[model samples]
Target: MSDEQQVGIVLVSHSGPVAESVVELARGLAAGGVTAPVAPAGGLPNGGLGTSAELIGRAAASVDRGAGVAVLVDLGSAVLTVKSMLADGDELPENTRLVDAPFVEGAVAAVVTASAGGDLAAVEAAASEAYGYRKT
Candidate 1:
């Protein structure tokens, strides 16, 4: 993909089986013409904490190009897990980014921002800002 094209959004959550929910949300965004990939963290029952981060990192690496990536998580545990994975020197691509996005609202905002062709930075900012809008 070109540098200007939206690459992908990674949703990191402690919620089990993140792919289904994340993909559904992505489909909603796609219906609005946003084609960015959505990668959800977390794994099945008995899976470890960092499973989601690993999955997200893999998805981010496959994006090839674009405005980079935006990562949104469900809670503090998910956030911490992602941070630890990145700090462990997993070697994510240069454009990948992690943001502290509020659970539901942040996901919605991130999806909308990304779908609108907004850059990763913009999407991250939107997700972060959404967290402060009403303080869920």
Candidate 2:
């Protein structure tokens, strides 16, 4: 990764506040504060409850700084929205990876890993591992 940028992350949720809060919380979890860009694409563009492909696509592209991005989403439709957006024509950076994991947990993991200078694959792996987390 370039010294100018580490891997970035995009958080997608149905509620704008939910996604924004996750980003805030994840930034705090970073060892020395978040070094990578983290963008939240949540809720409808009108501020209603929903997700928008255009917003998500913009968020992902905004965070990407040549190191690629890891997108963590909440709910099934958020995934579908992003997928459809990507398929529709908004081409993301080649290194972008859509990670399937628990939203809050995955966002925190991904942000921390990215802050630590991990590459796109490393960040995605960190997020994906959250799927197996147990609080027992």
Q: By TM-score, who's the top model here?
A: 2
lDDT of 2 by residue, 25-116 (tens): 88887657678899999899999989887778789889988888888888878988777666666467667778878898899899888888
Q: Lowest summed-lDDT stretch of 10 residues in model 1?
A: 44-53
TM-score of 2: 0.91
| Residue-wise C-alpha lDDT for candidate 1, range 1-136, written one tens digit per residue | 2435775776666655664487576567547665666666566346654445456667677653656777666666666766776677655676667777676667777777777778777878888997678635
Poorly placed runs, candidate 2 (over 4 Å) = none
TM-score per prediction, in order, is 0.75, 0.91
User: How large is the C-alpha RMSD of every model relative to the true structure?
Assistant: 3.3, 1.6
Q: lDDT score, residue 47, model 2?
A: 91
